[model samples]
Target: MTDIDPSVYANYYWVSSQFYKFRQEFSDFYKSALLYLAYTSVESLSDSFKLDLAFDLSLSACWEITSTTLESCSHPIIKSLLGTKVEWLYYILQAFNNGDLVRYQELCVYNSALRAQPALVENEKKLLEKINILCLMEIIFRTIPLSIIAERTKLSIEDVEHLLMKSLSVHLIEGIIDQVEGTVHVSWVQPRVLGIPQIKSLRDRLDSWLGKVHTALLSIEAETPDLVAT
Candidate 1:
């Protein structure tokens, strides 16, 4: 039997550690894939092998993974894909990350090469539904009227309600939909593998909440001086 290198085992454990970090933090599958490809001594492999990896990563980004965000596209592994045959795949990832439905539609309309992918073609409706769900997640914070969701997702109010129901059923989001009032009161969103922009958005929301709490405390203190004294 040919002897395997001990370093291969070390690299496998390292990649596993990175994946664990990803689950706990904001990193995604692409980032972990990049780490594996970069550190696994795959530099000696042929271009075809790298291209295969890119294609698999793109497919995972589009359908296989639960995460819609692809914030790490600027990484070297993805960046090197520029001007390559899979360049459209890069833009597709960006569209998903940003929840740009119009851009995604445009790509599908213009890029016949993208349309040729059997998996994407077969799952077209599923992909559209996933993107719409991602669009809802991007826009929703706490509570939103159904009309606004319809406008944002480019779906009818009825469709919006159905979408929310599907999202709820899948545990993608936890919320209550008020058909009477035509609104959704979202209590939680599933944590996604985020990029820097998403992380900053989260930070800004936290700061805003802190500011509001501080203002409320000041108001309470001013209105109840006797209570504070007691």
Candidate 2:
């Protein structure tokens, strides 16, 4: 395996992707191709090939796979992308990884290179849906009002309900929607490989929780001096 040309793997991946595309098995194609790209020695490929592979993988329908790529910045393939024509592609993927709908929209509108991708142009609606789902994941509240979801996702209340239903159906999120209350009570969110931003978000949440606990303890001590041992 060490002696074989890296292009051999790249060529095989490309051919397999085309086969899956022909069958309209987009999810399978993305999963397999991304795994191949992640595991292979992408640095051995030409710079042109690396750029093309990065672009192709960035447009994957599987947000989990594309988003995970952001965590691999140290990988040769991802490192090779820096300071190149497609460097914006890294930020584009970061937007998706961070669930920044506004940034994603800005990139789409302002980046002519992104707009030129026929795959992206054709699947704009699907991409919107994906970004909305990502936005939902970023919400910290387990139980949230539809209005809040609408505000966060930039969707109408009706659309928010539909999006929640779609997310539920796909098992992206485990939750129940209360139509009368216009709220969703989420029990779980699908876990994925975390990138730097997500780790930072987790750290922030932990700090906030600790602060709240300290405040509560102080309040308890002040109000219930008789029950406090200290």
Q: Number of the top candidate by lDDT?
A: 1
- RMSD values for the candidates in order, in angstroms, are 6.8, 4.1
lDDT value, candidate 1, whole model: 0.75
Q: How do all models score by TM-score?
A: 0.74, 0.78
Pairs that collide, model 1:
none
On TM-score, the leading prediction is: 2
Clashing pairs in 2: none
Taking the tens digit of each residue's C-alpha lDDT, what string does model 2 give over 7-41?
67767877887787677576767666666775476
Give one digit per residue, the lDDT tens place, for model 1 in 1-230.
36867567547755664575446332355555655665555466577766666665666667644453453454445554567887898888777776678888999999999999887898899889988888888888888999998987889999999999999998889989988988999999988766678789889999999999999999888889788778
TM-score between model 2 and native: 0.78
Poorest 10 consecutive residues of model 1 by lDDT?
A: 20-29
